[model samples]
Target: AVALGVKFLDAQRKELPQGGAALADLVTLDMSGLDPRLGTVKIEVACDVQNLLCGPEGASAVYGPQKGANLEDISIMDSALNNFGEVLSRVANTNLLELVGGGAAGGLGAGLVGFLGAELRPGTQMILDITGADEKIKQADLVITGEGRTDFQTAYGKVPVGVAALAQKYSVPVLCISGDVEGSPDFLADLGVATCFSVAEGPTTLEEAFLKADEQLERAAWRILTVWKLAEECQLKKLRHS
Candidate 1:
């Protein structure tokens, strides 16, 4: 009877049974007030896992190195991921070592696929589907989307790109706002983004910017609305004259 139960459990693991259940935990370290390079590397690794596995690598890299890992430590973690990828190929008969988004989360992506059978899909697509953003675009007067930063990466399946595409299908103008603008803003025009704005007034340190993010966003919002109001007034005046 015990042997039968054990066999049943193995079968369940091999094939997702009715009422599928996920048994796992994702751990991330709290890395704050530490070396920024290490922190960023850790975050990049975790993001890789999240993109490849279930949801994005939410916890690990985002929080890790802040807890005290240095560049050397990050490299060690990266190596671990490479080795894990090799192991995954042997066990799963799928080589995720070279997969895009595979290097996320210190190789957490490899770990997820190798150990938990997760698959990688574009994060933007997932968000669009989940939010019914396509339908929303059809109804909206204007589409507004934003991020902490806008750069070349924004073109790579980021929220703004996804939202802009949906807005374009409805022939609606899409606007983007970001805490900082990097690279060329004109580049995003091709993505159905009509315009982009950076919140910063001028040069400021990272600490000052973060502290002022909410206030800056509020001010930007007011400015945008004010411009829209002026445009509306001009249109109304023209109609009256005509």
Candidate 2:
């Protein structure tokens, strides 16, 4: 499935402004001229399922602020998303302006669905399916997964939780090693994680942590693996005695 980025697509639209590229300029576009090949393939997108194409809770208004957008920028970005959505909708003969999750990734979700015959799914699910994670998990004795940081947010369709779900299907233990860890260990355990470890050994600035990331990660992995080996040996001894 082709997941198009709204900003990237808008910047590429034939319409251009004098100062720079602007999404609002594309409002006058002809939808009938959209790519014809888009109809032939099934497109799926990954994003937050609750956001709409345009408005207060929409992509631009909600996410744009964090991207360094001032009030003026928010208005322009919102207008651009609306323009893109409307044009794509007209060309594809499908209305997606208020479609759920349409605002994800700056309205890319809506644009692809409206213009490219795409559907939307959780990003984790999409990645797992694409990577054949289920098949891979079934063959492994233990699964190790990590990210820059892990927290309760991990349970909300994040990578580690997604991997844990697959590993759990085969009753395999899952271990998470990350740059930083938040929430309680029990929280991760409830999500099917056997345990979690952080590369950060003590309080340190982000710059220091980044510089030592490689060394810290290698040391953390070695320690976990060593401990796991001992645990396995103990289990084996118990089984033999029983």
Candidate 3:
């Protein structure tokens, strides 16, 4: 099967002089057997493949449908990816369809790994390393982070958890700001997130809440900063009198 796939690709490569380089940096073929539990891993692979392909748009067209893809669009994108994959196989002797992560983002992840030699790394670890979040926590007076929502999955490398882990290492106070604070607050307390603040003042429609998010965020930040400033001023005044 792999040999036949490779032979088919070689024939297609002759048509494109740049050798499908313009089509995609990588080609992913979506196969059906992917596990759902590996969704995050698959997403990371898809994003990487998108980078290897021309960019996010290429990846989105190829992989976006699995999340919620229409049949007609998926078919068109699939054909494009398959042709690109064939070209890669002919020139590089790499059968992208059989590769892991190849089926990511409709098999784009596999395509990148197979054709572009992209490596798969844990997404959280990559983010932590790149952001220097640990170092930031070590140096900051306080660390604040949050997400759109917090759930059991939050422990599985969500932004809040990642920030809290780093903050814990430094014994820094970590505060979470969320759209809604559901679940037990005590659950997060154990994780070293000192407090979680909900942005909502009262119940309202979804559209109304979204419209006010910017103002609410600013108000919250201002309130926090004002308290910090006032406390600092009082401390300075006391020191001067002493």
Candidate 4:
């Protein structure tokens, strides 16, 4: 936005015209680039998410909490994004508001596609294809995937969920193990994740959590494997009886 002479006023609603980016009254944009558009340049932007530009699953509502933004902040910011999206669509002749992956990096995906005519592809899937992940997932009976954190945003195409989507095609189960879990991921079951687990044994301070992360993860993985083995043995016993 700086390059385009647009600026965001991230201030409280009560604070006024001095601090509102998404609120239409306090917003202004004039991004007619001095340079001509780069004609015939094929740009492929990789996104790890599939969030659209607006709505509940969009950027502000989904990611604002992680950045310390409260409900009020999210409401205001989302409104502002509406204004930005309007301008981008008009200027670029591209309808980016509801485009998939448009919410990546809080609408950076929309900006790139709107202004530069870029393509947004799932970053994880692109990497998987290049590394032949389909074959590996097809062969695995169960897939264990993880990330530093898992939350509602994970459904919008985080690594664990992305892997789960792939596993579903082959009827394989997926277990999501994370450092921590939050945000009511009830939909994960429908996405082929059998369950989600947290490595933390109990509550701890941030510093302590980071310090003991490796130790906790190792123990958690061991416990998970043990349970898996027990389940496998039980299945075998049932098979013998039948």
Candidate 5:
């Protein structure tokens, strides 16, 4: 099965699927057999999201705004997704809407699952396992992870949280330093993020933040390192006195 969402559902309405059309119906799949050039292949869709299909947290409602989809467009897209989910459920003989990571990359997760019977994998852990990150995290004194933005959503299968899961196994503290930080501090802590902060030092416009990204990152890094050094020294002094 081919991936959808990232390409098919763009700002420009290229070819909107008709009402109640399964995503598979919109595309033609070659089920005759695997291509002769490639031998048996196992399909796996790795994504760092857990949003279900057809809901507020679904792809259209959550990611549409970033893709230049306005209210009218989001509403339309959501309705189309609901209809598509219903049809795919019958064809796949499975509940695509309830599939974890189904909303990923704009229904790409659902597409792969429905059409190809591909496995939905948690991308971060999968990649980290491949990259031997567990060994590196085990040896490191601290683990630093970040994303474009950290908010309530970050708690839901985001990159930083994925890193935190591995680091926590080795009793390593995880610090998240994102371009932007939102949601409550408690919520962030609950996600196993020791601490998190935005790169911006003060109020700044989106354009300004983008332009000053490098400088802002440097300043934030400096601040975090300085505080860390002080904490280390304090610990040393306390040990000496005790």
Candidate 6:
């Protein structure tokens, strides 16, 4: 089963089929006589593989702030994740607390691993695996990819880099476009990005940039392809002269 929400099981409150009134809420867990068909199903998730299931640096504490989780919410959620982890560990006959990438999507990563024998992997890799991206890359001469921003982090499993990696396998070049750019072209080129461009041509606020993103991207792509055609013609001319 593909679970999206991070909160696979809540411990603090009563939720349907997933939670209870307190921490360590599961007093009973029976896994015997389960369907054999489950083993045939492969489960995978897209998330960082470095996050712990619980603690200050765990999934909740680090990602909670962005989800409107205040200090109190974080404290409560962290405890809840701890309880949930304990229950999963007992049922699965293995400890999930230290499972790398277990904190992805809240604590769902750990739960899937414990419950379904799922494999937790980077988002990019999972997507490529699922979509048969390598086969598609083989059919293409070039790959263009983008994200909200291009920066140092882009080298680390970001979409552009992920796509670029696959394309690089067949020696296909990659170009990236983004809402904004925070790194130099040289840095990105070394990471296999042939060139990177921003949608915004001049100074613009975040609000304005978003409003014009579609138009800006369209124009940027046209400009890039036009330049590429010109360069191709120039190369052909040089070959003929030689």
| The best candidate in terms of TM-score | 4
Q: Per-residue CA lDDT of candidate 3, range 1-242, in tens?
A: 12213222223433222332234433332322343443334333313221223223344353455458676655555556656666556655666544434544445465545534566554555677787777767898877686776654455345676677777777888887787777766677777877777777798887988999988777776676687689889999999999
The TM-score between candidate 3 and the true structure equals 0.48
Most lDDT-accurate candidate: 4
Residue 161 deviation, candidate 6, in Å? 2.2
Error of 2 at 91 (Å): 6.6
Q: List the RMSD of every prediction in angstroms.
A: 12.9, 5.9, 11.8, 4.5, 5.4, 5.7
> Any runs in candidate 4 off by more than 4 Å, and if so which?
4-40, 183-185
Model 6 regions lying over 4 Å from their true place: 1-42, 48-91, 94-100, 129-132, 185-190
137-224 per-residue lDDT for model 5 (tens digits): 9999888888888877787798999999889888988888899988654576767789897898889899999999999888888888
* Backbone collision tally, model 3: 12
Q: Sort the candidates on TM-score, descending order.
A: 4, 5, 2, 6, 1, 3
Better of 1 and 6 by TM-score: 6
Structural similarity to truth (TM-score) of each candidate: 0.60, 0.64, 0.48, 0.83, 0.79, 0.63
Off by over 4 Å in 5: 1-40, 68-75
Candidate 2 off by > 4 Å? 1-29, 41-103, 120-132, 240-242
Q: How displaced is residue 192 in candidate 2, in Å?
A: 2.5
Candidate 6, 79-148: lDDT as tens digits: 8778878877887888899888788777778878987888878898888888998998899877888888
Q: Rate the local accuracy (lDDT) of all candidates.
A: 0.60, 0.75, 0.58, 0.80, 0.77, 0.76
Each model's number of backbone clashes?
15, 1, 12, 1, 0, 1
Tens digits of per-residue lDDT for model 4, 28-139: 3444542454546788988999988778987888878888999988898888777778767877788889789998898899878877788998888888898899999999
Worst 10 residues of 2 by lDDT: 1-10
lDDT-based ranking = 4, 5, 6, 2, 1, 3
